[model samples]
Target: MTTVAEAASWARDLEALAIRISPRFCRLEARERARRYLAGLLAPLERKNGWQLAEAAGDASPDSVQDFLARMRWDADAVRDDLRAYVVEHLGDPDAVLVLDEIGFLKKGERSVGVQRQYSGTAGRIENCQIGVFLSYAGRHGYALIDRTLYLPQPWAGDEERRRTAWVPETVAFATKPKLGLTMLERALDAGVPCGWVAGDSVYGTDSAIRRTLERRRVGYVLTVTSGQRLWPGTVSDWVEEVPADGWHRLSAGDGAKGPRLYDWARLPFRGAPEGWSKALLIRRRLGDGELTFYLTCAPEGTALADLVWVAGARWTIESAFEMAKGEVGLDQYEVRSWTGWHRHITLAVLAFAFLTVLRKAAIKGRGPSRLGGRLDPADRARDSTPASPPPASADSRHLRRYRLVILAKTSSAESKAIALEAPYQNR
Candidate 1:
């Protein structure tokens, strides 16, 4: 259990991190603004809008908040670079993975720079929105979004007048989401970010340019591909059809909210594997519908199927990062419209997420809060931490508490089973 003092200390440490990196700002006002802004972001506000941020700063009005986002002389790109460095310094590992994904931000008007009727994965339909391609670093230490780039469709990229109004520089070009992801990957590599594998959904995986970019850099990846995606001699589904009964093995990708996600996986070798490299078609078959999902994998020879599956699982971490960031730190709850403002808001939001991630890790290390209560500590924690210590309560009361806990756990297990039976599991 994290005592009140410990939680307060953790918060102070997070604030100190913001202060330590604030020197990157050219002006003292900018530095202080960043510090307070980050604190506001981490606060448990239902709506972290400009007005709420100003209120947190004890201001009578939101004028300074509006100016801080629009006219402040701060370098958001520099802070982005620092965010990458901070993530790497804390979470870097030799076997860490770089996960690439895109998130959509819903908008009301067409003037929010890049907002238009587009297909949004979040909404599952066409919506007016802006999309940002993000790269997250995940390892044993933790995961956090390290780099971000906004995706501008060709229409916006070509419209000089719109670009002028949005303050988009003339040097910016129209790049597909995959292309932007590749740029972030290349930048991460050039920055000497340690990573062993890359993973993304079919949008990026099916792109030959993306795969070849990784190949040219000697980086390995476990990436999803469509059923129609073809190899040198055959399509992905064809390779899956050819896998014999003995080729498939049951494996757990990784632990999830429910438990380890188990699936029947098979790997089929490809024809064009280069020297010291291995390529394969990795497939997952759903137990209920026998539905198939394919992954085109490239790695060094003798890489375990378990590791490949693990890499595929690691890609989902970005989704979790996105969820936590948006839910806890108001990642998508921004009022920015210009190109620079969007980048600045996202960079700070991600920084706030990183702060929470670090605090969670400290909690897990036995010096911070437990999820059991989020307020009141659960009784199990005492039993866990004091296994060898003598009970402080009476023997009868201790036995009674243990009996109640066993019953509660059994009921919870039964409830989980009933829910799983009620709703069949899908690949997603």
Candidate 2:
């Protein structure tokens, strides 16, 4: 249950956020309406479309909200920059992981911007939908989606009539999902969004350019790749067959809803790492059927295998954020079809999601078990052949449970230049 004081604090936080972005809106009326729009996004309405949101704001019609989203002269990109700054202010950590992934918004019509028959993770199959490439910040305290790009399909990009009808900007061009993810990553790093590692699934991991860019910038990463991904002389699957049974170490990547996600793990150095940097193949095997998953890890030399596992686990943080944003904050409950309208609504939803995350972090602080960090008990370590490192002393040890993977995985930009990198995959 929400306490009155806590609710009041959330209100004030919302107001503060409104004031922070007020300058983006040229007109005072538009500024006020944006605030109401934000409030409506946070409201517990069944649908977050223009009608429902305006009704919740005590308006006779959705004209105000719709106008704010479509014709309102505010720059959505500017508001997004504010969202990024806000996330950093509250949840910034040096060990934070910047995660990139895409979600599909299922739409019925062909007129929606970027709508086409494509594979959407939301539906788990090819569907007519708009794909959104998103970047989320996952810090020790909490996580939130901070940046986004709508993937304009090649056909839509080439169709001038459709593009003009949807009010797509001339400056926008057809870019692969990985390229868009790369652009967002570059933007965040340029804006000084503090993070030590990057995590993504194969959509990003398969793009060698993305990996090279991170390497040049000296950022660590744990990106997933397919078993068939070649590593010089042989494929990853081929190398897996050479590993002795004793080479595998049982480890918990991180805690999930059910509990610690334990899997058999093995790591081996890969050739062709630049001088001072280390590259390795980290493989995970399911306990039940020995199913295999591979990760390409890049990090500073001497990065522990446990730390790579921790970073690999961090990729799921974005998935949970997507679920929360859509289920609680109406991230997908938009009725917009135009490019500007889509951006405006999504930006506001992102704001509302960030607000809820901050409130939840405050509500749970010092009250319950830490969500990500757990102390590994001796008995848990006893399952592995080699004894793990001594657990760090934590004030929350009383709240810490067994089988939790605990490590900072902190890497400096300077240190990252000489580190090995890892990779993971997005849900296809």
Candidate 3:
């Protein structure tokens, strides 16, 4: 149950964070607004857009909040750096994993920065949305997103007129999702975010640049790959066929809301790695259907398969972070259109989310690490329904399809009801 002392402690933590980051905001007014904006995000509003947020802050209009996001002369990146440091200080673990993923913010028009009809992992189909590549820190203590970048589609990058209209900086250019993830990863490492393993989906794992960077740093990774990926001059699927029956071990990937997520697992070592380092193919098989998923692992010699499995399972932590930020802290409920507007709102939302993560960590200090206090149940998001298919996008297809259907169903019902109401009037 919630207690008065616990609630007061959380408020104190928020104040501490505000004071720590206040230096980023030059003016006293900006700092106060920043505090209010963060608190407003944490407030239980149906929609945490600028107008609602301003009202919650007791402002006469949204002008102040909107200005704070768009016109404020503060470096969101500097604030992001502070956020990374805060997360490390509060939840850092030597065995922590740095997770990379992207979340799609659904938008309707062309005005929003980085909005285009692209394949959104969130909606499970091509939609008009802005994709933000995010890096999240997942430790035994807790998890939270530490850095993010708005993915500018290639066409948007080349369109000078649209760029000017959206206030996209001239220095900004089109970068693939994996490249953005890599940039965030490098930033975290450079900033001394304590992490031993990197985990991500195929969008990142398929990129050799990311793999090479991790290998060069001698940092280990358990990144997912396509079944058709070549590991030893042969496709991974074909290579897995040669494994003997005894080669497979049934193991629990990690704990979930329900309990342990168990799957049949196997690994095949690759030939070359520097001394004391190793590379291998890690595969997971579903129990009932025997459907398979693959991952490419780079780690130190003698690293146990269970450790690799643990890293693979930990990939979901970022997904959990995305859900909590959006659902609890209004990560996506922004009315911003310009480049600066998007980053400012997103950074504040992340700050609020991190504060909550720290509070949860303190609340469950001796109770053993609860999965974000059992709020990170992937089952709540229908993750288990994801099909074990081979192509690069299949992993997210199920959830995306479900999201699309839900939106379409809602739209259809409203449209049909309106049409019925209009038909009677036209007949009269």
Candidate 4:
């Protein structure tokens, strides 16, 4: 448990980071909102809704939070852009990746932007929900969602009355999740956000236009595809079925809660070669389960299987991130029904998550964890199994956010105290 002085110190650090990205005119009140809202989200409360956030802010009514989200003059996009720059500055690597995935936010009414009876991955069934395409940066250090765009279904897009009620802009039009992803990708690259690859599930992977866009941008990717998705060389299923018994190698995508997620992996040849790049069908079969998952990969020639496995495993970081955001920071606990309000809440939620993420990394840096784990400097890791050194603290910031934690799998028992306290995904 964190002591009073320690928790107070945590708030001050998070406040400074939040204030850095907060809009100029709203800094004073926004800093207060940032501190209280984040505390409420990280609090023991079951629901961090508007009323709860107001309570955290010591307000008598939820009106203040409602107004702040719906009518505040601050620019949501600018804050998002600032957060992106911060994440890149701290966690970005040339070998790092930008992961894309859509998450379902369940809603009861059709009034909410993009709400409809749709296929929701969250509920694992078709339900009335709004989907938001999110982009996360996964690197050697850590991963966090950096940006998002709510997916407005065609019904909401076509209904002018509904659009007006939700405060959706007239310029906003119907776009598939992949299209939304493409928009975010272009924005990141335009801002010179550093990353080497992109990864996503078949939803975005199967889109020819999305693949073409990545190809045009010369970005590498390891996106999952259906086994039946045909390739000129061979169907993914055909290639996986034909591989010899000795062809597979046991590798881990990354360390998980239980242990290293070990799987039998193989790479297949591509018939149609991409100009100045190579494409391969990578397959992973669960240990003793025989079930297989296929990924369509585009990268440089002779890219190590470890690298491909790393990217495949790294995609799960987004899932863990979603779990943390929703459970730890009110990512989906918003009461807003308007388009502007949804974006505003989401961007701020992401900002809050970023602050927690910085603290998480700082915890790791402070603890000086064994670099022997997969998360390490590539050259040092390749040279020997020796633990890599922690980075020097940044001169621009001084402090670490304090939170309770419990350690699990692959991590050292010695780190149990600090890792549990520092890991953003460690359950607030």
Best model number under lDDT: 2
The digit string of per-residue lDDT tens for model 3 on 122-227 reads 9999999999999988866688899988999998999999999889998998888998999888988887777788999999999999998988887889999899
Ranking by lDDT: 2, 3, 1, 4
Candidate models: Cα lDDT each: 0.76, 0.79, 0.78, 0.73
Clashes of each: 0, 27, 2, 1
TM-score for candidate 3, residues paired by index: 0.85
**Residue 355 Cα positional deviation in candidate 3, in Å, after optimal superposition:** 0.6
Q: Runs in model 2 with CA error above 4 Å? A: 366-428
lDDT tens readout by residue for model 2, 1-428: 76786567667778878999999999999999989999988888898888999999899998888788899799999999999998887676666789999999999989999999999987999999999999999866689999998999999999999999999999999999999999999999999988878999988988899999988887888899998898878888888876665567666666676656767678888876655568999888776677889888887765667777778888998999899889887889998899999998899899889877876665555322222123334663354313234423443221111122543223211122212222221121
Q: Give the lowest summed-lDDT range of ten residues in model 4.
A: 396-405
TM-score per prediction, in order, is: 0.84, 0.86, 0.85, 0.83
Q: Comparing candidate 1 with candidate 4, which one achieves the higher lDDT?
A: 1
Compared to the true structure, candidate 2 yields what TM-score? 0.86
- Over 4 Å off, model 1: 367-428
User: Candidate 3: which pairs clash?
Assistant: 123-400, 124-400
lDDT of 4 at 396: 12
- Backbone clash total for model 4 is 1
Q: After superposition, how far is residue 169 of candidate 2 from its true place, in Å?
A: 0.4
Give the number of the best model, judged by TM-score.
2
RMSD of each: 10.6, 9.4, 13.8, 9.0
Kindly list the per-residue Cα lDDT of model 1 for residues 242-282, writing each as its tens digit. Answer: 87756666655666787666566788887666667778899
Candidate 3 C-alpha error for residue 422, in Å: 60
